[model samples]
Target: MSKNNKEREVTAGPVKGEFISPQELNDIEERTDALPPQEDFWKPPVRFGSVPVEKEPLGWDRRRGFRKLFPVVSLPTQVVERVSFGHPELEPNRLFWGDNLHVMRQLPSESIDLIYIDPPFFSGRQYNVIFGDQNELRSFSDIWEGGMPGYLIWLNARLYEMKRLLKKTGSIYVHCDWHASHYIKVEMDKIFGYGNFINEIVWCYETAGKSKKTFSRKHDVILLYSKTDDFYLDVSKSPMPRKRNKHMRVGVDENGREYEEKTDAKTRKVYRWYFDEGRLPFDYWTDIQFINWEAKERIGYPTQKPEPLVERIIKVSSNDEDVVADFFCGGGTSLAVAQKLKRKWIGCDQSRVAVALTADRISRLIEEEIGKIFSVPDFTVEHWGIYEADRLSKMPLDQFRAFILRAFGAVPDDSQTGIHGMKGAIPIYVGEPNQRSQVTAKEVEAFANAIRKTIRYQQDNLRDGIMLAWAFRPDAVQAAERLRDMEITDLNFVRLEQIRIDHPRFREHVAALSTDHADYANFLTFVQPPKVEVGWKRLATRSYIQADINKRTY
Candidate 1:
């Protein structure tokens, strides 16, 4: 976290203006006197029963971890936009703009090879409200309602999903700080298991701040856990620079290469160390520093981390072409590092601004950072629960049709010219992708004829047909009404339902994907992108004379 986001520390002991009044001291004394005892004493041994973490806070609840938590309801994603660097044949990396829990639910289980999440620490409001997004604000409020317990429960559910999403050989790195790292450690143990716990790395950095009353907090804790005991880790992929002590003898080998030798006292054997073969890294890392304001990598994110730090974690845990995921991706440090390392990456953030920033950062990487751009696979900007209706309306005809069909839970068909897909026995015909394009009367008649030609309609006698579009023309509705009335004379017997994209029927399709949890009602929805206009103006420049300022100060 940045210095501006640091919480104002308040001390309890006596200082210049800080004092405990006489009345308050008297009350405290009275309360202390009323206590039964303060002395330490030996008590009788008590027998205890072990309870699994599935039952929660106290482990008494009958419901398990996922059952008690709000389900990450699976929803169809709309490929509203794409960022490609000329490779459409390869699988594109994914960038999701939605709650990560739900996005993870939609991903296949055991797909990710490594995950690094920098979730919001339970520090306070200022730290959690990084983007001021509605989802983040609501989540922080829920976290503070019950204090520590509420925050743990909210995080435990996501951790459980990450565990399920991780491959058996996958590893996870959770970044946090002093505020709630200990509590999170206990909860993570419960979710990932005590045996799976790996390392508790301390990331030390230098910053300009000191506390006179107490020790300054300068480091952050990164908890590492594996999905299973067989997790992959290659230390040689990223090793520290070799260092030698003054006691070691330095000399040159026969090839004139500089080398250092150390004698083993017990065996009286000499061992030589070379500079090219670097030393393995340690759990305590201090070489990497924080991103200063003047640093080019600083992209104005309140809690953005340095790239070198993220690179170390990725290099050790994953191999080339492996999948790396970051559920709480803020300024895209992890994604950019993964890209540079040649790993397939997935990033998700609830804040639209955060997701947009991530896409821009990766786009820059593809264009300028890596000179060999063609090798990089293109990535897609997908929206899960929150959709972009305007973007969808502007997509290509085939793409828009596929989006609507997938949202409607229908299978796409290309056998017929007019028939776009099928929803059970009923045939579906989609209008043009442009929102202004309306369903015409001629199109309705054509869809009816197309449905009648289908084997299901001819043999199964399926008489239902559906036309979905932005809006239907008045004649189109009238045409459907006329078809229903003339059914007695027509042997084909077709009934067409004209539905607008914004109709209640489409909302039902979205709502049908929600879990039993009530909070999921607002889970899947389409919202127009926020309107933003940029303007700039030259400001009057003011100059100050050093002589005049010095004279005035004196």
Candidate 2:
């Protein structure tokens, strides 16, 4: 029969394919083509008649949650400086200033014992609150244009890396709210598996406000999950008070401890409950309070979590000396709690203000809390994606001047012709140094002119002016000395040490340079000011002066 004219019969029999006739093969191909399209299949095939080949999509997944995207690429980081506090013998904790996703990817797999992160919720708003210093402001937009899908993609990428860093027996607590809690839970289940989910804790609190349109939303959901089935959790550490049942009779034990006993009505079994043994905490948590504005723990950072909440989690999920981590360490609450609990910690944040606040807060905590017996916690501060010297050299003169001024904690003055900004009462003149050995004579002349102009403009008293550069020529320094002697303005020829002092990792960089130049070593020693503790009574009697002049100079 002709190929097109022949009627191919489809049979439900195993066709041996070792050697088939050409006509039979043609018939099989034709039969396959005649079958319905795979997309039109009624039901997707199940694995082992139970497990699903593909996950069933929730309503949000179909509209906005899951998405198809390329894999995330992690960037490298360079360690800038290591800081040590009261106890220098303990292993230094790590603080990275960069994208947490990239930083977490660089961490060793299965190294972290516990992870607690309070990432930004999809609140569709911008936060631009300044916490510590006047110039230090943390502004970030958490609104996603692609809505839920984009938010999930951004979060899921980090979560994947977080899972890799978590040990098999480690646990993670993800803090979220009603904004995207349902979506977050679904994605977490898809990554960590539903069987490993431990709890969906509801943290309820009583605030002052109420919504008239609906019930007041006062609770946040904390999804707890383990990396594997064999996870570690100490529920005994987080015990709550339990009231005695009315049917139970109170009695004294042999050791004089009070106890209560009751008989089950259905099972007819007797049970003894000790008064000393507190009840285990349920998933609903209401005891912990939020950080109010007047709270001592409040560091002026909005969205700062309470310390007790993190303390309970750390105590329950991890032991002493275990590794703990917080990727979105806003105000460093987790790091502070971890340090107090004697656990090794790693913290990362992209905001410079956050890093600076964390560094300062940790230092103060060591001094006040742990410095009496143990040394302050030793830690390293690292900045990722810093501009190389070559790249910095290529920057425009105005941009370089502004960058140097800002890095040195001085505000750039665009209105003033020669002066960069006023660092305290001193006028700053920044000279351009593009990979040069010394500041040029022309730059020195301009600085002298700027000093003369500033003096003439002020017309009050001869004030000190600072001339900053990478390095100063002997002639330039001599010229500055001459200008200072002239009494027009006391121009001091200082190098970039002033700028380096503001950097968190400046000590390490200065130490590295000190090997080549003994002067750099001396500069490092000169920058270390004497520590002074001031009380309110002293401040009331006299002017409060900060011991660290470098901090106030800016």
Candidate 3:
């Protein structure tokens, strides 16, 4: 699974070769599944087989009468940036900068094969603010408000969406620790059926922060769960080499391979086992070490996991060309590893700084590490709920119009001349992508005439119109006002509203949602790109400047 074989070799069992073939492994797995639960434990699982898929946004637990709810909202993506590797024809993998719950809601159901998320660990400490961004800070604050229950509720909302996005045969690996693993497990059981539980992997590593009062807490827990009963599993993908045992009776087979013989005393049947086949893994893993500050893969993210850790999970869960996703991408360790492993990936992070850093990290890998055989040629970084006006102004004309229509919750209809879209019996016109280009009186007149020629207008079904642009010329505003006044007295009355892109009413689609929570304040916000200025001055004399400022351009 990793380059450092010795460091990742947790154990080599004495009995390995007996469970190599597919038939034997399948038979063993079947028998294990048929066994009954322990008498002292194992309560019956909740029967959610008939709970319609549309109700996935509704949360529940094993006990009745208690429900945690999530609102199903669709905030489409805005392409912020696209990193290219010379292949323009390939579709770009997506990286989103937004709340993952809203982002995942827009994704197609059952599209991803593997999902690995490392969300906030609920440490309730200041160090969790790694990027110092308002969005990241808000997420951490919201989760820690009501203590354990609050944290679980916040995580369960996203977890429910993740369950909807995962394929029927997919797997999810959640990396957490002692803080709230037990609570999360019960919630996951309620979300993903309890019978689909896979393993509670213990990743052991030694680091500083040893305590004298109790045993040093050095291990992190990884809870793995599947979406369905027939999920895929291929342990041989992560092969573990075993050592030879001298006590076993070893002999060479006819094919010049080493083998061990096991004889059934009653039937006198001898079964041959091969040594080259791989061994199964233990739930307790100590081979892979934790990433220190000086590690090469470390990019300064506080909760960044090692690439090898994600690599093993991806290799075992998904195949090549399969889609992998990471909803809480801290430093994008999972995404980077997936790209190198030839798997298409999608990643989302709420912090702008983390998204920027993750994009840079992946770009560096594309330029340096992933060589000629790189199959992943492009990926796009998109923003949901939050948008960049500077980037939006630079998009192509058609792209900008489509994005505007989607953002306004309107259906784009480019078939009619001068009318770009419609929203509930109202015609809409979109201006140019360049913000400096203002809407003209001629354009407004043309849209009015075009709508008058439409069947909906002749039948008296459409009487309203909305014009969206960065700015409207005075002549255009006057034309719209004149049309509104003149048409109201005539047989067909038309109301046209000339609205700028920066108008608060432009965000009415998202603003009308339930705003009972304070976190919705940042959604549907338009942020301007920072303005940078550079100036140079003549500094002929070195003695005139300080040592620090002297090194910079003057």
Candidate 4:
């Protein structure tokens, strides 16, 4: 919601450049005069024998049809590529890079079983990327010009879509902090109904910082709400360690299990506590620790929640293979935990870097957990508001040319003789619209000729030039090679592969693990499956070394 300095300020009354001619104004006045006078035009029509409507909920933004605020750009539907690790028949999970509102709209209603979103908490600050090679410096702003109202509007729109996506028995968990949490709770009550409100979990963690103004804010609020009263919840999955009673001593039962009994002083009632009865987790959580810098699970992402935290939520809310979704999946912690728990997941984030890191992290998890070679959990990577192959093929010549140039980080230059744009003095020429077909030798020769002309006729100093196309024919590659040998012009013909690599839509395929069956078998025999816990320390160290070697070799 934070506005950039370059953003234009919105004003009321009339938009600039919108002018009504005198004749046009006169026509409007004439039309108004022709109509017969009636009752107050703004008054609501009276209804008889209709169900009495209750007063509209207070604090609710009754403005409907706000989807118009965001123009829907037609994006090409990407083909879902399967990259199976263990189960090929299982429905592939999905990872999307776009606004969650648009992505949720595309999903079918009443399909998802569980939804967990850790959206921006209206912190009035920018959450910048702390790690990741590409987007380390990028930041997401939580500031809103309209303040709480604007934040509510933005979140309410997405929550409305999410509610529709949830099944009758589905549940949602919204994570937030003190800022705007009260407002969000009110908005959620209006949307999900107060009757459906569940527990509000307090996730408490220990950190270094302390506030001098008041008590240190050490906990976050996670609001849990179900689509309906009849929702799924397995609290038994997340049990806490039972605390010992100071008033009673341990006694042995008939089953040889330790038990403790305490007599209430006021009520004179005896209560027995067995060691085997696992205690249910309270609404307030402090068992799970926060991700520290030295933790192995730390991926160096800002605000990355610990895996155990999300794992508990997933376990409690969803069954195996149930579809779970995280709209604001910053580092994909929810998606990764869902996958590990054997749940189908859908995650979306606007940051390409976050998506990239999530894909890489998930691939490594698949490798380490499922022990698959050259495989990852099957999932599709998609970009919204970007042209796909089908749409690109149908686009007009000029528009398509412009799109290609812009996608390649170049400006379209019709003024240039042959080059489309200049990328830091390097002339870029977009090949003909061939729809993934090969670029022929004739096309390559024409580009070569243009470069030669620039060097000879224009007296222009040209070091190198590039030709972008769908694919290059063998002869075309040979021609470019021949020209490079002659030193006339160093023309590099870049094909779709290079472009796709540079602008990757899917996670790069992980290298196949070395298939040393005998060695693996020997190690397994020595460690034994039953003793894995005892030997994991040594095994993990060896695995880490192997992974490092593979990283270097690959």
User: Quick one: best TM-score, which candidate?
Assistant: 1
lDDT tens digits by residue: candidate 1, 166-189: 898998999999988988876676
Per-residue C-alpha lDDT of model 2 across residues 1-554, encoded as one tens digit per residue: 12332221212111222111111112223322121222322242665364332253222232322222322222234343455553546667888765576567557778999999998887886443444333222333332655786677667767766777789899999999999998888777766776778999999888888999989999999999998889999988977666677878989988998889988999999888887887788898887878877888886666788998999899999998899999999779999999888889999985555765686677667656765655445787654433224434555787667655544546678566767877666678877746475776667677667766764446866557776666777777677667667775566665643333334444333222201111221221112122211211110010111011122212
lDDT of 2 at 195: 72
Clashing pairs in 3: none
lDDT of 3 by residue, 1-554 (tens): 11221111111111122111111112223322121122312354476333322222133432321122444333456664566676757766878776777777677678899999997787885433444432223235545766787677778777866876788899999999988887787667666766878999898889878799999999988999998877887877875544466655789977899877667889988866677874566777766788977889976667888887888889999998899999989778999999899899999986555676677667767766674566555777676766655555676788778766655556799888878988777777788877578878888888888888788888874656777666677787777778878772111212112223224443332222212243332234444544211112111110100001001110
lDDT of each: 0.66, 0.62, 0.64, 0.61
Q: Model 4: runs farther than 4 Å from truth?
A: 1-64, 79-81, 128-143, 251-259, 263-270, 275-277, 371-377, 387-554
Worst 10 residues of 4 by lDDT: 540-549
Clashing pairs in 2: 85-376, 86-375, 86-376, 87-375, 87-376
What lDDT would candidate 1 get against the real structure? Answer: 0.66
Worst window of 10 by summed lDDT in candidate 2: 537-546
Which regions of candidate 2 fall more than 4 Å away from where they truly are?
1-80, 86-89, 130-143, 244-276, 373-377, 387-554
Model 1 is weakest, by summed lDDT over 10 consecutive residues, at 545-554
lDDT of 4 by residue, 1-554 (tens): 11221221212111111111111112213322121121221233465433332222222323423333332222223322234455555466777755566566666678999999998778877554334333122333332545776667667767876887899899999999999787787677666776778999999999998999999999999999998889999998988767778888678888898888888999989888887785799999988878988998887667789998899999999998899999889778999898788788898885555665676566667756643443334675554422234434555677666655554556677665777776556777776565567877787777777766664335755647778766677898788788778877777765543212122222111101011111211110000011111111111100000011011100
TM-score of each: 0.65, 0.57, 0.64, 0.59
In model 1, what lDDT does residue 196 have? 78
Q: How accurate is candidate 2 locally (lDDT)?
A: 0.62
